[model samples]
Target: MHKPVLTIFYQFNPWYSTIGGIQTLINTFIKYAPNEFEVRLVGTGSDRTQKVGKWQEAELAGREISFFPLFTLENDNFRSLIPTTLKYAAALVGHSFASDFMHFHRLEPSLAALNWQGEKTLFIHNDIQTQIKAAGDKNAILWRRFPAAYFALESLLVRQFSQVFSCNTDSAQLYRQRYPSMGDRVKYIKNSFDNEIFYPLSRTEREAQRHELAKRLGLSEETRFILFAGRLHPQKDPILLVRAIAALNEPHTHLLIAGDGELAADIRTEIAQLGLSNRVTMLGALPIEDLAQLHRISNVFVLSSAYEGLPLVVLEALASGTPVVTTRCGETPKLLATDNGVVCEVRSPECLADSLQQIILHPENYPSTSCVRAAQPYAARTVMRDVYSGMFTRWEKRTLSIAS
Candidate 1:
């Protein structure tokens, strides 16, 4: 029997250079999806050296994936991407490969799926309008300038797909309300963490890891370390977090930053200006294993992003038995509804500082075991895999029926 073909359309960079929550989700599916179906991941390349319309192929975990990258761009500013978008859409439609169903990972790429006879699914990563508004003024102005273009890509494409997958309850609610007629097509599938890679460590193991991290950072055993492990960008609001660290001003309160981006210099300058060079250590884009170890050792994981769909790092932190302090962004409230962590106001240094202080002062109030338990439901891959498999099976059956 021939396996059904499932094509996924989106912009992906296997290099991990342009990382985000959506890329993380796409990577997870690529890593874990069973071999019952033939998968084709169609996307743009992250490597700038790759020529326009170039097709690259590779095998991952014995599964082959064809990567078709668009023409190289000098930078990632989406404002100048209308030409790239048209080119990608043309390439996708012109491709000869036949698929039973197409899974689109973003609104921009859904343009390729238009008028395709095969069933199509939309994966809602984040609210495009929310993201546009969250972007700083200059970028926001581009969207306002091209309101019709944004509407056509975001609103119209959302309705074009036959099925939609919302990564969190917040996104699920947004789609259901925005497209009431497509209510049944919208489904919620929470993002998950791999159990083998992230889990709670024993007390002795945790202590040993903590000691090593402390020694490396020149921190004392009594020091309370707070970790921030996402990109350092305007939307991520790392500056707001750095300001919060300054406001806290406790000698024993140490901040461990575990990622890098365009704002690295600004963050370093802020730390120096605040006289926090001794207290703040920026690790700068650590390997996954090291990041997981840091999560295991840290007192609290903090995410101060302006918005998110459902951050996988938060789940990883919880899986490592570390509590999280995040802004009220995306599905954070639902994820933390069980009192697994604290949610503070967005873009407010004072509120964030106070929230972190509460956790720092009364660590016992949030037990490590509760955090671990709260993340257990999302750790296993069975549910997520089943959802994808079911969708593929249904689409495959529908295609066969149409042929008969």
Candidate 2:
């Protein structure tokens, strides 16, 4: 009964405040792993107090949470991170923990872990090159420049991984085409949402709660709120969300956002310059519970990101029975199969606005539940079981091969 030690490495605060879907997926897995397996999640970066290599161990929902110090000097031209990267690398190299399987959430840590030889799984969540290839405008050009170092690092990481999980197949194939020798190692594992937590409530109850909450917050009944929740980063294209909402401001539709990011202030300014302050409201960052309630009350969920791995938030919205209208960025098409929502051009406010208008004008035409039940396979526990079954089968053979 020797259960293998599984070490998971990712970049997140690992707190309730982190609002990305990747964080949701990892946290869900941490909250549901079997009793026999020892799951250790090592992450860097949160508050500014912890410096490089300073790690603290804590418990979360019966899982081991290891916090590591991470620092970086970011600028418009380049990000100086070698010092912290090497320091974190040294700490990992210094540890001799017997991990039967090592899973890395982000490419940076996965690349660092790849420096040493072991059975490893790396998730190439998105492909920048493919995104660049998918690009049709000037912003995509900016991604090419700002993400060169990151792409080079991911290339190095992919070379050392035993298995690869890509959020989409096109990106996976693009990366694999680079390494002709490493065949069948790359596969697509789409994102899933927690249906149990995000789903339809009673119509009467939802209406009453929505009415009461709106009154409590001093929101008007005419505020037909559309929501877009994610970090305020370039990838998310929150500005586009603002522009879309602004373009559709007819004194009846309002856009309420519930997330924080580096570009929070800039997005606010865009709302003002576009004369949209009255229509757009930023709730900053709220807890996941509050986020779900907001989703419940929303008419539609829109994701304006320029790119994504697999946008789990879209799935969560669909699961909640709130139809979605997001851009065709990243793996959104893969994540949402049901005709429950609409997809528009990435960064095109006009396209987004038009889609929103259609949904808003014909709200009764859309079904509340569509293809949500089809997402059961993407659950963390469900996906993890498939991973474990495949990995253990290989491990036993490898061990037996060595024994023989």
Candidate 3:
């Protein structure tokens, strides 16, 4: 039997080179995809040295996948997105002709493929309107000033796709209610974590990893770490996390941030102002292996985001047997159980601090086994199998319709 060719597109570099939920999701899907399907990736190449429109080959888990990189200015600024959006859309239009199916990770790329005649699938990473409202002025000028325009655009573009996947259940339901006609096409798909890399370590093994991490960071092994791994942006509310850490007022408790973004300087300033400079450490962006180690050793993983989809880091933390204390956003309220973690109010440092303190003070309440068990349903292989099966089902239906 001939394999179907699937082209996946996003407006960022390949997952291996970047760190984010969308990148990780695309990479995991490709990694665990059925052996019978051929996959190709299209993304932006910000490296000025690499020429755009050139095809490159990358190996993931012994499988060679084709990658086409487009030229675009990569930055957090709103103005920068215009060129990136145009470039990704143009590339999708060109690649759609040869692809058996086109899969888009986020709205921009999916909207760009509106003109494509082939089977198209979109993965909505977050509730866009909610994200905009939560972000307030921190969002782009256009989105912040006129959110209705963006909402209308999203409503228009979403209807054009054959299949739509939302990582958050709440967001999925919201979409279903908003677009009753396409409710069946909009499915809720959980973001997954690699069990092999993220599973919990034995007590002794975890201690060893903790010691190694402490030594590398020049901290004492006795220091209790609270890990925060995500972009340091307004939407993620890293500053709120810093304020929460200050409110925590636990001398032994230290904060370890593993990602970098435009708000790095602002976070540093907050740390200094709060006299948490000594207690807070920024490790910048880390490799997945390093992040997994951090997860295994940390007392608790925390996120103070204004909004989210189903954040992969939270799932990975649970898989590593590390409980999480995150704000109520995305799928967290439904995903987190009393035995696994706590959910705090969004943008409230006091609430965040209280929740973190509860988890830190009574770790036994949130058993490691319970945390790991909660993550089993979202195992990368299992989720990816379901995603691929769904896609093939849709493809089969389209084939039969064409034949008839």
**Which 10-residue window in model 2 sums to the lowest lDDT?**
72-81
After superposing candidate 1, which stretches have Cα over 4 Å from the reference? 15-18, 46-57, 61-63, 72-98, 135-145, 337-339
On residues 127-222, what C-alpha lDDT tens digit does candidate 3 reach at each position? Answer: 876877765445432466667887887888888887788888878888899999998998887789988789898878987877787787778877
Q: How many clashes in each structure? A: 0, 0, 0
TM-score of 3: 0.92
**Range of the 10 consecutive residues with the lowest summed lDDT in candidate 3:** 75-84
Q: What's model 3's overall lDDT?
A: 0.80
Tens-digit lDDT track for model 2 on 242-279?
A: 87776774556778888886678888889889988767
lDDT of 1 by residue, 36-126 (tens): 7667777666566655576566675456776666545443423343545455666666654447768777566566566667678888766
In terms of lDDT, the poorest run of 10 residues in model 1 is 72-81
Candidate with more favorable, higher lDDT: 1 or 2: 1
Query: Could you tell me how far off, in angstroms, the CA of residue 147 lies in candidate 2 after the best superposition?
Result: 6.6
Ranked candidates (TM-score, high to low) = 3, 1, 2
RMSD of each: 3.1, 4.0, 2.5
